[model samples]
Structures are given as C-alpha cells and as structure tokens.
Target: MSLLAQLKILVVDDTTTSRLLLRDALETIGFRNISVAANGEEAMKMMTTSPCHFIISDMNMPKMDGLQLLKAVRTHKVFARTPFMILTGNADRNVLEEGRKLGLNNYLNKPFTPEDLKKALEAVVGRLQ
Candidate 1:
C-alpha cells in the first residue's frame, strides 16, 4: 500500500533471521526506507548519525537493550516523540509496564503476522486513507 513510502524505519534485532524477516515484512508492506541494526548499541550509533522517523526494536539484545534504547530516545529532545515499537518474544508484565512508562508507542509479541506489523504501523503513523 506504500503506507511507509519515504518513511525512515530503524529495525533493531540480534538475530539475523528475525531482522531479515522484519525487513522483508516491512518491504512487503511497501516500506521503502528501512534500515537494520544488530543490537541496541548499533541502533544508538545509527540513531545518532542518521535520524529515523520510526524505530522497531527487540526487547532483548547483547549490548544495551530495547528499554535502554527507549530511555535514551526519550531523553534526546530530537527523538523524544519519535514512534517506538517493541517487538519481543518476552511478554513479561514488568517489561511491558516499563515500556509503557518510557513512552513506548506500541508492543507486538513475537511470531506476528504481516497484518500485525501493518496494524502497529498504522496505529503509529495513522491509517492511510
């Protein structure tokens, strides 16, 4: 649908498979500007150098983490209100609560479908008429 046309998206995940899967999903949904980060540390670096319109991150990673990244983003005035979505396998209540408090835009559990991703993006970007 090209709902994400020209919209920069930063996708952070530790697993190559997961990263590729998400990237492909976004592409299939017509997202043109998609970037990938292996972990939160890499994501932070990328975010600093190249700002993005949206960020979809995994909750767990080797260096830094989704929550840490979220906190950093919130503290940065430039990215404070940028849309951040957590895509995780872990569904811990505490984690979700923390994410909510940190101003996370949305949360999606693992094994999600293309529709799930589309819905989340729509929620953040608003449904394209």
Candidate 2:
C-alpha cells in the first residue's frame, strides 16, 4: 500500500463544492481514508471520536474558523503534532502570520489546482510517493 493511503485525512470546509474538490484531489493522489467536516466544531468532534493524521481546513467558516480550530488542536495533546494545512481565499498576511504562529504546516489559497494540493500535502507529510 502507498504511504499516503495509510493516512486518514480530515478536510474541513464550509462549502460542499470545495470539500468535494479537495476529496477528489486527495483521491487522485491515492489517499483512501479521507473524511470531511463543514466547520471547525464538526472537525473537533470528529477528532475526538477518531483522530486523523492530517487536517486541511478553511480559514473562514461560519461556526469556527481554521485559526480557532488550529488553536483548539494545538491545545489538545493528542492532536498537537498532527499536520495542519490551511485553505483560504484571503491573502491577508496578518491572518497567515497568525496561522504560522499557531503552528500550521502549510497554507494553500483558494482556487488551487490538484498540483497545488499535492505540493502542500508533500510539504507537510513528506514525499507522497
């Protein structure tokens, strides 16, 4: 089995389209164990129930934003070392810097391609292959 296939990834985004797009990209890269959450709150709940190896979360969400999720994960000993990748349409340096401070593995802007997602995932978890 591929190394990537062993990883259980959690994708958190408010939009159904974004979630589906991300899932397709991940599947294309040979990731089989993938899960989705619409917001940080759901993500957290899922984490408590079944922690994931990696997380891809949108920076902006209605219930709980990515930064807040990052903070919450960081505080939890079980999830502190899990790889986190932030997805955002906003290019605000301040927001990015804040995520950096909170220990995000990487960040990908909106409208990213499959290659962009692959690169971000590789940067966090090492070579996908």
Which number leads on lDDT? 2
lDDT of 2 by residue, 19-125 (tens): 99999999988899999999999999999999999999999999899999999999999889899999989768999899899998899988998899999888887
What does the lDDT read for residue 43 in candidate 2? 98
Off by over 4 Å in 1: 1-3
Lowest lDDT block of 10, candidate 1: 1-10
> Quick one: RMSD of model 1?
1.6
| Model 1's TM-score against the true structure | 0.94
Model 2's lDDT to the true fold?
0.93
Instruction: List ranges where model 2 is wrong by over 4 Å.
Output: none
Candidate with best TM-score: 2
Residue 63, candidate 1: how far off, in angstroms?
A: 1.3
